[model samples]
Target chain A: MDKKRKYPYFIENPLEHDRVRRFLDIFSAILETSNYRYILDLYSRVTMKCSRCASECQIYQATNDPKDIPCHRTSILLKIYKRHFTLGGWLKAKFTGGSGLTEKDIDEMLESYWNCTGCGRCVLYCPLGIDHRIILRLGRYILSEMGIVPKNLLVSTREQLQGETHNSSKVPLKALQNTVEFLEEEIEEIKGVKVKYPIDVYDAEYIFFTPVSDYLVEPDTLMGIACVLHEANISWTIGGTNCDGVNYGLFYSDSILGDVNRSLISELRRLRAKKILIGECGHAYRAIKDFLPTYNDGEKIEVVSIMELTLQLIEEGKIQLDKNVIKEKITYHDPCNIVRQNRGIEEPRKIIRSFINDFVELKSHGQYGLCCGGGGGTVAVDETNPYRMNVAGKMKAEEIKASGADIIITPCANCKKQIGELIQFNKLPMRHAGLHDLIFEAIIMKDGKKHGTDD
Target chain B: MAQMIDFFMKPFFIFSVSVMILGLLRLFIKTIIEIRRVIKTAGDKDFKYTKIFMATLSWIIPGKNTVNTAVVYSIVSFVFHIGLILVPVFLMEHIIIWKGAFGFGWPALGKQAADVLTVITILSGIILLGYRLFSKQRRKLSSVHDYLFLILILVIFISGYFLPKTYSPFNVQVNMLIHIVCGNLILIILPFTRLAHCILYPLLRLASAVAWHFPPNAGKELNKLLYGEENKKI
Candidate 1:
């Protein structure tokens, strides 16, 4: 007899009976009423056993586990969809029995889908053109409905949704005001130029939105934005309501994703801001720039990534850079959401080229770039960090090592955190900086002096 | 004996073809309606149709994104798919049968070409089956239905090849009957199984483009219907 592998999250501390029952009830109901029936139908009938997708998958490359294959991961959900929702499945259950959704199935779905980063890299290489990312999102939505999401994502999203701070980090108005004030003082001290971090300035040309991570952890990235915008003299203000651009819903729940996006739209209307300016976060840019038009109706608001703005500013000579300031070999870590999913492959490279003299490409760069192994909220969950370092992060760490770049420029916050951790874990002598971090360091201030030196 | 073969063969062929046509049509219409629904309500209004077509065209041609990574598998798969249609439609033996049924036949490939293409089809089927069985990931993803479809195709190819040339101890006529029966069964079942990829691939690819732009609030209407009215409005 073959020994069956155990999944602890499902089997060891199984969901309470009532919760499982409630989940089953709601899930079964969802099966009937949603477009999932169509999705299930398409998935069950469309996917074949070609195994072409395995060669390109980073997770499978790391673990060598068949289950980590993108197609195989989606297959777990497909099997459940077939068994529970299809006509043949119903008939089989009626006659042969024992093919219904079980607690184990729930566990397996969670394990397989969560392990995936919802990256579209596999889709790019799948012969069938199956968007396994969509299927993974549907899986995440299914799990979120059952209240079976990572506690961190859930808490942060809830705080962003219901809390007074209007952002995931629960940063209140006063805290945000203080952070801005502090950032202004720091900028004045360092650059010898007083720049204001504009907050809720009505009729501003752009309403800037960034991931709360920037506000909480990556303050330097925000400061860089302040310097560029101030030097360019662009009228922009970070929104006060739902100032955080990161929609955790895009990761876990479509409803929450919708809710968060809707909140942003409402904020935009309230601010009467002409355009939405998203900072250097990848998924946040994806959520507003890529996702908002799909979800909302008749919104004429123009959403632009700050990278694009910076590039435009460079072309217009609105900002000047001292290209000799940061003389270190640097490699750019492409965030999957931005580069592959959102067609942002060239913008960052263009910006990077203008500032760095010794830039090198990773073996797998641009559209073919390997993920930093921290996407799709993997960086948010604590339990998966070891896996990130040892298994998923293995290829990425090697890629970084082989590139031989002293500094790694990550435009996305998640990549910064995850790659930052991978650097530490692998004991690699790599430093993490935002793309704007380099720009901030290199840009000549209005006084025609570099930021750190006054000579 | 000939009458019995005719009795079993003609009806089976017609029934299988009818099921193949009708089943595929239903799938096509259902998928179309689903697309229209999504496109009308939830799709990105600014979605580029040219981009969708261009993306589809890129995937269809060799040396594109999908084929660049797994060159061998994609080449073999492309060759096998071409042989799949070519052998069945253009083989001399198949043309004779088509003429007998429809009173018309197109030009057929020479015997040598038919033999080579048949061999390619059979080999591809076997390779696909072997891959499915040997690769732990492929095996895990595959269902019995997936394996059965490959085996059925292999059986058809093998039995069909043997019908014209003698390799079996059994009667050639009996072997021909088995080949015809299996071929018909495949036609009947293809649209229902994962082999539906054969017919549904193009539409699904386009649908994926639409789905890529599928709205975040696309499920909002469904949520109301499923969970009852709760005002977590998007």
Candidate 2:
């Protein structure tokens, strides 16, 4: 294939082209100024070459390509940073091989930045203790300003910023009321308890928030949280208008990330709940748990992961689990956002352990857990880069095969869909379940009734 | 003879005094402040132990590159730095002045140990430079500054070795003048280059040690912080 034609493969839409142009313009301005020179000087003086960092890169090991090395990525950006930005680089550009940035440099950057998972695994391994994740994030920030982000990600983020929901399946005020009514009926039939799936309940002790995807695609997980909360007689209510827990701006851009977080924070504060319970979504949890703390400027608020809260209730004997609800041998896949990035390693495992008798841990658990391939909005971009879902899913498939478990229990929705598709595509004889599905199944009724099989 | 002694001793005494003052400033004042900043921010508890272990092992062992590459470079950097130090302080002529000034005297390692150590350190420095070129990983990450640093060290080491053992051609005065000027230039450049890592490493380790033990916030406080209790969406 011709190299010019190869460039088209990366640019899927005109918006991307425009965004790239905008980014180049801004960078061009920076390059023409003394500020750029100062930045280059600081960066050059601070950045160092370390030989011990070679073994730590996962992308390098996976691809066996030297270009995939974490330091190589830094070098690419650093070279551009030096060339147009420094006096030495300017002088050497004439004699040395240091050519300044062109349109091609931006294209290469777009491809490179998107490939990084921002896992911080390399940061852990770097002997110099450099945070390469910061470099990737800075690249993303520049890309965002250029408006060259992936289209599907951009649309969803725009929707989230406007409607407070990424999915069109959002439960608006009436739908939310109807769903609560429907859930109440289901609760009466199953648990034989009269519980209110209260909406906009003032002075509630807890405001239970979940992704809109849960209301449409996986109601069982949402219902599971409700059933557990109802059984424990905890005072909780779902938000009436902004029921979705997702923050799409976390992926699309950085400039809007603060605003996206502020919008979410405003909704949470409006509810006046003593505590906020985030549902079993990986990226959502990360946005709230990790990113929010950095952007929110030390704002004090109570945000607890649903898995953590469930484990707490089980440990306190506030809720009892009937083990027979899940009789199959189960293995847990730690979502990358929760386990590796946010250090939420044990909470999900504790919840799974409490309910499942035949639980087996995957070989690469906790900090070393592989990504579900659908993370960072890759799963949402079905129309573009569809192969990323499967290509990245390869490691996950191998991990599951090695576990020898019949069922895979993970806490994140994206992981569920990604792993579920992998199972279907590979024809693996294993089913996937959300952690809440098992938890809800194991919840004993108020009248002492147990559901599922008696093994 | 008196004129020659005065000419040699004046510059030697000035440069040596300057170096000693700078070393004292780095060791006593600047190092303490940097260490304090590192300790204040480090989240890990084991960082203190790791920092000491890595620093000590850097000199004792040969190729164990841990958190700080500067430590390894500094060890082999002895050729350039020690030659720079001793050529001013403990040279046969300078020792005579120290005895005159302080009324103190001691056994010096003499020229043999000095020459041997200088050769060993210089060879090690060259090996490190060569390693950067041959190692694909290092070469890819290396900047112009890195290459420049390696060349600078090579110049200092090679020139010092070739300069007259006693008095010789190339005008000992001119050679000594070049050595003093270049040595001072490197001293000024040290704090700004990757050489700054030598000062930053201990502090980084201390910070890492202290950062490890930070408490996991209670879910209640975290929940409020993450999703404000007032607005109910996220």
Model 2 CA deviation exceeding 4 Å by range = A1-21, A24-43, A49-54, A84-98, A164-196, A291-298, A383-391, A453-455, B1-139, B143-188, B201-234
- What DockQ do you compute for every candidate structure? 0.52, 0.13
Best-performing candidate as measured by lDDT: 1
Q: Residue-wise lDDT of candidate 2 within B26-144, one digit each (tens)? A: 64355456445433432222233655456444543444443233455445544445554554455554466566655675666577766675576567767777767887767766766
Candidate 1 lDDT at B117 equals 91
What does candidate 1's lDDT look like per residue over A1-455, in tens digits? 32444442222233455554655666576565445666667877888856687888888888888778888777777777777667887887889985566667677777887787776788878777788888888887777776667777777887888777878888888988898899888878778888988777888899989988787788788888888999999999888776898788888666777778888988878888899999988889888887787666756578898999998999899998888888999999888888875477888888889888999999998877888987888788877888788877789999999999999998998899999999999999879899988887787788545655655
lDDT of each: 0.79, 0.61
Error of 1 at A205 (Å): 1.6
Q: Each candidate's TM vs. the true structure? A: 0.93, 0.71
